[model samples]
Target: MVALTGTMGEIPPGGTSREFGTAYFDGAEWWAVIRGKPIMARWLDPIQPLQGGKIVVDFTTDGKGLSSALVIGGYTDQPRPSTGIAQEVIPAGLATTIVFIGSDGVTYTTDRFIGSYSPGDPIYLTWDAATPTIIGKIQSQATPPPAPPPPPPPAVVTGTETLLVTASDTWGVGGWGRWAKSQNGGEYVYSGFWAGQTLTGSWFYGAPRPALQGKTITAIKFWIPAREPVGSNNAAATIHICAHTSSARPGGDVARVVGPFDVVVDPGFQGGYVNLPLTFGPTLAAGGGISIAGDPYIGFLSRLKDPQVGKLIMDWSA
Candidate 1:
């Protein structure tokens, strides 16, 4: 069916009162199809079959909104089937006229714009001798091919190092937090080492020193300092503070630091020691412990005996 628009005298007097397009008709339905908008066509009377050439088609509207019309111009003398439905054998090539009226009171005709049509391709048609509307989908075209298979997903890579301290030093999951007296550092295994042996250590609280409250510490004191590599063969180290007395959460970057410590490779230096001052910011809580849990082999500290102490300071709201 077609749609009509515009006001009455809208059509210029001598100018083209209105413009219409081609039409199409399926075996059972009639439609007036246009390119962009809808055109309206009303049938004042039933369509009567013509004996020879042309047929008279009449229809009218208030002319409020007038667009192009879909005129059903050909196939007036075609015989109707026993069911009284308009029937015609559409030609193999060239534009053809196919017309039919739907139960909705709209006439549809095929203008056969392009020479031939396969199934699925839409064919334009119009009914009411006026502008024809695109009725429905053509039944001749083949169905579309199935969609392509989805692409494969990406792969995940896993490593073996256990002393995994994330790259940040803030205070929560990615930051530093409060430490408790009896805390066990996180569990990790040494996979590969640039240098030095793999050893495990946990975090324990030292005798509470008032000056240590609210300050941040990067090193913990061992009952006995262990031998470790220095400079070239230094071991990677990490530190974690427990949020709860029994829990050791991995601290951010600010929680751990590494430097050269003297190893007892030479016996002459009776119990040589390496100490790194646990000074960075004011981040540790008073009476809370410090933990130095990482690879502690010989010669790992750059600056020996500098003494690392835990300190606590203020942090902005997370």
Candidate 2:
């Protein structure tokens, strides 16, 4: 990644595999910078919008017409607290657009936080132009969809929908015990799916998201099904639920921090649901799924059966 002000990175020593570019940590590890293509994009939905971060900008020398987007880098407004003048003066480095993978499998880019927009507002996406990263601003440039040929009454809105995770969750085996099926014919870890128990690593996924492919998520709720025998690490514990986007395991750094939730024993004590009430929290990306793991990497277990399959509640709109 080059500086946002257009500084070039140095070439590596002759025999190394590293590319001539920059890298930044995503809170978990250093990421080899990938530049953005200077593509003009159109924002789509989840009915949610974007907030900015490291931009995926086109690094090609032919880059043109991009100076107009670096309105907000978040640090320049330092001492006084507000970027009151950033809207007028562009920063010293080049700022590109933040990246988001579309449900259609195409990558789209926009500035950090995009407010409310309709169907086709254009997202001018670029990446990697500053020390940390630069984000290009999104502008509304597309024609709105043709207004419905109307004589019909407008349809009323409905409440959100929920998705459940009953059996064969994407979560796999715990090191201590092998797989055993309950009466419902679903598989669960017999011993415990706690940390240090697995050589493979442990991070449990609760929601069933294949159906909510294109819809935006408003909330994520989880349930730890009842276990006849409460085991170690089974008592009330706090785990950080995170939103992950790429191939690697969810590390210290994640696209969105969904925040901490306490997994406590319910009043009945059979099993527990996430204890804290989620009146409000972060908005997750469309088509993206969350992972349940602990801070400092503690122990966690998930052994469930029917009537209480690995339950995941998701609230979202069409």
Candidate 3:
């Protein structure tokens, strides 16, 4: 059987030209008959089997164009199928050609057509011998599952706290008023030994105040009075702040040691109590009481006090 199919431009208002052809026939045998009159015909062939072929013609109309139609009328020596349809599965990324004999004793072909596709893609092609066209459609397959939801963000912990002077103790002193002094109008622990007198005096210790527990101390501020005893030139003292395991006086330094910050009493008792600020490393634990030790130089104030009224600032997540 022969088949013919092709696209055509829109017919003009007056008329338009169209053509068709096949490779099976010689040019001399082709003819165009209109109203019982023989008209000249053009044959574009000598084409290979299953290859495209064509015939050319220009039509003249009386202000009316031809209607869309398909005409199949031919005689062949060999018998052909009356009607035929075929289906084929084409894989992705492959170009293929489809050829089949039609009911009109003509061989039809869809020369090398490619359907660019992704992995696992399949194209369903349906060929109709009457239309002489192979229509292709992508097969329906399961859609990939949606990407797994992004992992949840890590949990965050946040809080706030404060470090306050909980409890204060004076080292090397028996009675309260004896080894204590008033500084900035607040009672503070004092070391009341003059310079070179066995170097004896009092030290101060501070722990978290009541109602403020589990607070991390970030910084501390205190006051110390430096006095120049008679006949002494610049009397200096070294203050040490150590982190202890407990609130008692003799606990070991489990957390850290701050410093031996020096306090100088110039000649003639030139300096008053100086304000000292110490920032802790990574914030001291409130459970570990901070120990304060003082080592005084000759003529340095021994009876002076170290204030326990310092701010113990802490931080927590809200």
Worst 10 residues of 3 by lDDT: 1-10
lDDT of each: 0.32, 0.35, 0.37
Q: What is the C-alpha RMSD of each candidate to the true structure, in Å?
A: 20.3, 24.4, 25.7
Order of candidate numbers by TM-score, starting with the best = 3, 2, 1
> What TM-score, to 2 decimals, does candidate 2 have?
0.31
Report model 3's TM-score to 2 decimal places.
0.32
| TM-score (C-alpha) between model 1 and the true structure | 0.18
Candidate 1 per-residue C-alpha lDDT over 205-253 given as tens digits, one digit per residue, 9 for 90 to 100: 3334444443344443322222233323343333222221212334332
TM-score of every candidate relative to the true structure: 0.18, 0.31, 0.32
Regions more than 4 Å wrong, model 3 = 1-139, 146-152, 155-158, 173-187, 191-238, 248-286, 297-308
Candidate 3 lDDT, tens digit per residue, 196-302? 32222223334544333443333344333344343324434444544444443343223334543454444554334343333442324434544444444332233
Number of the top candidate by lDDT?
Answer: 3
Off by over 4 Å in 1: 1-199, 206-211, 214-275, 278-318
What's the lDDT of the predicted structure labeled candidate 2? 0.35
